[model samples]
Target: MGSLDVIARALWSALLLCVISFSSPLRAQPEPIELWHGRVKADQPFLDKLFKQFTAETGIPVHLRYIIFKNLKVELIGAAFSNAMPDAIIAPADFLGHYKELKLPAIPDSEMPDTIRPRFLKTVELDGKRYGYPFFYGNNLMMFYNKSLVETPATSWKELRVMKPYYDKRNIELITFSYQEMYWLVPVIGAYGGWPLEGKKPMLNTPAVISAFKFYKGLVDEKLVQSDCNLQCSLLKFEQGKAAFLIDGTWSYKRLEESIGDDLGVAVLPYIDGKPMRPMYSSHVLAFPDYESQGEKQTKLDKLRDFIFRKDVQRQFYDEIGQIPTHKELASLVEHTTDPNRKAHFHQLEHARMMPIEPEMSHVWQSLIRGWERYSMHGFSAEESAVYMQKTVEREIERDTQ
Candidate 1:
């Protein structure tokens, strides 16, 4: 045993240790949970604050990206094809229709926070599985009036029609709304005893649709509503006291309250010929995409979900933004609140129907808008327009399914 042999053995041992260290994998750092959403720009700050708080509490960082609502779906599909999809999406419940296409795994019902209202939870459930977390509900249209201009809100369209001449003489429109939006037209169809969707099928070619078209045109012909005005125009007219009433969705409540102050009065949609104007409503949801691929990231997402649905967090959603919270207790508070506007909103929700959650409902919307444009701008007869809508949507559904 010489000094040379002792040095060679030590060198060999060091070389082997270096090779093993280089070959073995080091522990990987946790990835930030990535989320994509189509919510309005105003929501970003509040959402950022929430995410920051979550990171502070759990040491798990979150990254968010905002995509335009119209473009969100196409991009999600594109990303899915490219294997570059985000971990989750916050979007309207209609995105549930893409659950299969996006390979979004069902969020076990047991994993869902019990604080969410049952009805809101149902929006994300299709067949028997829950695919998303219901964030908030109550996007529906109601009639809002200027109390100073109209002493009483009209409960019936016939009564509203009777007040047209009075408003005309005052050089003000009796009512105003975004005349071309198909969302607004759903209530009209409901008043005529039709729903655009009955399960997965669209009922656009019915007598109800024809009547709805004719009724809307009659309002324009009788000078009861301004057909040329868009939503912003109608909002401005109402704010400036130029219009006695406006029809709009819950999303505009805070803005209307700010603009009109005490003069803002909310009411359920006016009735037509003994039928109620059942406006369509829907919930916004937080959905996971290709969740099975997430592996250990699921645990972090679980914490994020719990944080997002916490009672305090849900309440902030209402307090900060005008978004209605989906927590049962908070929704009950709003339902029973002394605030007249909140009460009116709850009452409207009582009469409103949830928008069809089926993916095919998208076709109904596209077809209905086309039919409306034909009747309004192209001079197509109501019956013709109705027939066109039904045929078009059916064709689209068939083509898409195929």
Candidate 2:
């Protein structure tokens, strides 16, 4: 009974303890939150600082994946089909409804802190459910002209047309495009008081739309602007001194700085008949996808959302990235802007109109692009283009409404 039995029993107890410890689950570290975003030159520094701060404070890691702008939609769709969606995505505002239709998780307004709600634009809401938080917002319809070329910028479309002869005489093309024509001709139509659709029906035959079309046709006919260049080409033309003015967004400041150097200038889009034409402004929004609908992940998302909208984070976003803060109070956070031309961009935010957030916006863009091609490429009259656009608009509205 003695020492042998005592030693055997002790050994058995040690063996049992080792088995229990080995079988137990290892303490797992929290998984890092994955964020998918579109290609942005300005966002890197802000995000790097943000991720460092987040990790230091909460021990929660963040991973970022930037997708090419043109490939984003297709990539998202492919991810959704394969059940490989990222935890969160920053997508274009117009594409929100499409994501919603795909059953992505909705970020309710109530989920956001009350302090952050008023800073966001109302257009971000759809069917009373807030989908995403606005990050970057601005119009591309505005033309930037070289002040040295045109001492006084034209105030309205009428003046622009009147000055065409002078510009042409100088052998300077007023505008250049990479493709066949401009993308958003909606502003021109609006300038002429043309509504593409009347109460969800096509109004292609309206007088206002026809007049707007004629205005663009006149510019083409006068050879003031080549119908051949697109956004990229237009920028190149302006940079090379081939053109004096070009229509583009605020995001182009960096590129212009590198290309045009000391000659860059900024101004709002020219008005039409003394009335300012409202142009579509694109925005990026942060959204939670459907796959993250439960458990510890949802709680982490809520915290991350709060972190993103914090004043310090928002300030960092604006200062480093050059994006306008959605928070009205933090609008002045971008004080580090060195270029005077860049500062001029901040003033245009108020007049900027949000792009259509409807699900059928894709269809509308397709139809609009085709209509522009017809008028600019072929000999179609403005009246014919207007009629065609009106029908397209009506069809889009009907498709979305259903």
Candidate 3:
């Protein structure tokens, strides 16, 4: 136990410890990527399984946080200001409108697939630079009818007009829809070849817009449509067999199927002035928040986007969630399946116009809806309603500018 013997023993022990640490084949693990999504609250099991696959294949672990869909933008903005934004965010397409202002990076074009944009990626793109890819689209509207009541679906507005009296005689209301809402009204407006906005100005007062209002009024006047129909009311009317036809979005299919059973038939909207009744559509998107485009985080984001959008993944999500595919290859397989109603839905979606994704779209929706309620439910004429819409929207725009 002399001083030299004690020192040698301590040195030998330290050397052995160093060798064991170096030979153990473990190093500092990289930080897990954080992803914020709103859908996990309801789809946690699906997301959990899909995410496990993502991690397994790429070896990039992720932390998924569920923010409420409505609050996602606010949360992301808060995160940005606090310098704690997640590595990525999964939000509805409208939320991406603030990406540039939030300093988020555009997804590299090379990493995006061309098949998706034609159908699903509609409003998510801005100024030719897309910020993200669509995860799923279920926003398009379609015509739902009772096959037992109506032997054949209406092919034109004129046909529906003619068939109304027959259905009325049978004690069935001809048609009904969520007529008070702007999203519901936008489809009819577009079908008549009118849109609510051109850039930032209101295009609510046009020949087509006036015609659409007139058409709506005619449906009410002829007793072919419920005058003040709304979501719950219309669904009730249709489900109870009080209404022969209902205009609803793709999301309403399951409920209708459950309520109406095998007699539930889906159809492309009847034509207007020789054109198909166009519907408004949109989807949720996956995006990155202010990450360097060529950096490590961006590379990981790229891989995630590419991986999630694969045809197999798209099919799996559609099978589980009933989201219509935007992938070219998968779209065919999904729509060509035995589900004729789903095929019809995809057909209508193909022709549907996507709702605008700009921040000003909020003002447009509210202004148009206010005017619509006045015109459709109250006694205001189409002209008077148009004037109100234009003025209200212009005032809102000016206020925003100020």
Candidate 4:
């Protein structure tokens, strides 16, 4: 055991160790991509199965966290300030209103697939940049009636009033809806030739707005519509056949179908003064917060985005969850469906208007809700309430912008 021989043996061992380390680097495995959503527990099994397929195909893991729908924005802002944002979120189109606070990156046009329907594209695009990819659409309102009570659906508000006497004789209410909710009120405003927004500006104090308020009040005062009815009350009364007509969103279709079966009849919202009633429609979207800073993870998220738009994936969403796909090709198939209810939904969509996605819209909603409360409950004149809405929303917008 010469000293030179011992030194030579140590050198050989060190070289071999270096070669092994280089071949199999000690780099840590990446964490699973986190996605936040407000989907109900009933959707768990489907989402689990879908993500499982995604992971299997791409070798990337995903983790889903459910936040209550109402609190998602607040929680997201908290997470952002703490520098703990998730990889992505499945949010309603309104979430785009928080783009600046959340640092959500605009998805480049080239990255967006051509298959996305043009209408849905507008939901994600704010100003000149796109912020999200639409997953599914259809929050539009429609008219539903129990065919056993009403033989023919009315085509206009005047015609609907004509049926009140027939309904009175049968001891059935003519119609029921969420009279106090701004969402329902917005459509009536549209029917009266009013729109809440005119290219990012609020237009709440107009002749049409005052007329809409008066007309809505008249419906209650005349007993032409059920007063003091919330969504649940309306649904229950309609299901039990106490109410002959109901105005509800597309989301209620499955429940109504189950409750009334073959007796369920759906139609477009009735006209007001020869102009069609226009309901607001919106979509749930996939958004990436801090996307530009995702670094190495950006490529993986891109794959996930593209995967959601696959024809087979879109079809699965439609077939399983009854979500209308945002793909134009699939939407065309829905348009030609043989099912009567499906056809009715498409017809309603055709007549509906896209809801505004601007950040200012948040202020508008809050202001309108306050105005409606005063007009409907506090004995304020329709003109006064309309003026209050316009002034309140303007101040809120100015304050926030400054």
Q: State each model's C-alpha RMSD to the native.
A: 6.0, 5.5, 5.8, 6.0
Residue 97's lDDT within candidate 3 is 69
**Which residue pairs of candidate 3 clash?**
none
Q: Which stretches of candidate 2 lie over 4 Å from their true place?
A: 1-30, 41-53, 117-119, 148-150, 161-172, 177-183, 195-205, 257-262, 291-294, 332-351, 392-402
Better of 1 and 2 by TM-score: 1
Candidate 3, residues 5-77, lDDT tens digits: the string is 9999999999999999989988768667799987634366778889889999998898888876658777888
Strongest candidate by lDDT? 4
Which 10 consecutive residues of model 4 have the lowest summed lDDT? Answer: 38-47
lDDT for 292 in candidate 2 is: 56
Winner of 3 and 4 under lDDT: 4
How should the candidates be ordered by TM-score, best one leading? 1, 4, 2, 3
Instruction: Order the numbered candidates by lDDT, best leading.
Output: 4, 1, 3, 2
lDDT of 4 by residue, 142-164 (tens): 99999888788998889999999
Range of the 10 consecutive residues with the lowest summed lDDT in candidate 1: 38-47
Which 10-residue window of candidate 2 scores lowest in summed lDDT?
Answer: 195-204
What value does the lDDT take at residue 311 in candidate 4?
Answer: 93
Any runs in candidate 3 off by more than 4 Å, and if so which? 1-49, 52-87, 101-103, 113-122, 161-173, 199-201, 217-223, 227-229, 236-242, 254-261, 292-303, 332-339, 377-379, 398-402
What TM-score, over all chains together, does every model reach? Answer: 0.86, 0.79, 0.74, 0.85
Per-residue CA lDDT of candidate 2, range 1-402, in tens?
799999999999999999999999989988988888774554556667777798788788888887877788878878878877888887777667676544576665567556553535555666666677776555345667776687777777678778878878888877654434334466676667754433223445677667766776676777666766776778877887878778776666656765675777877667877876656676667777774554678877777777877887777665555566666666544534666665656545544555666655566566666676677678787668767866776676786778
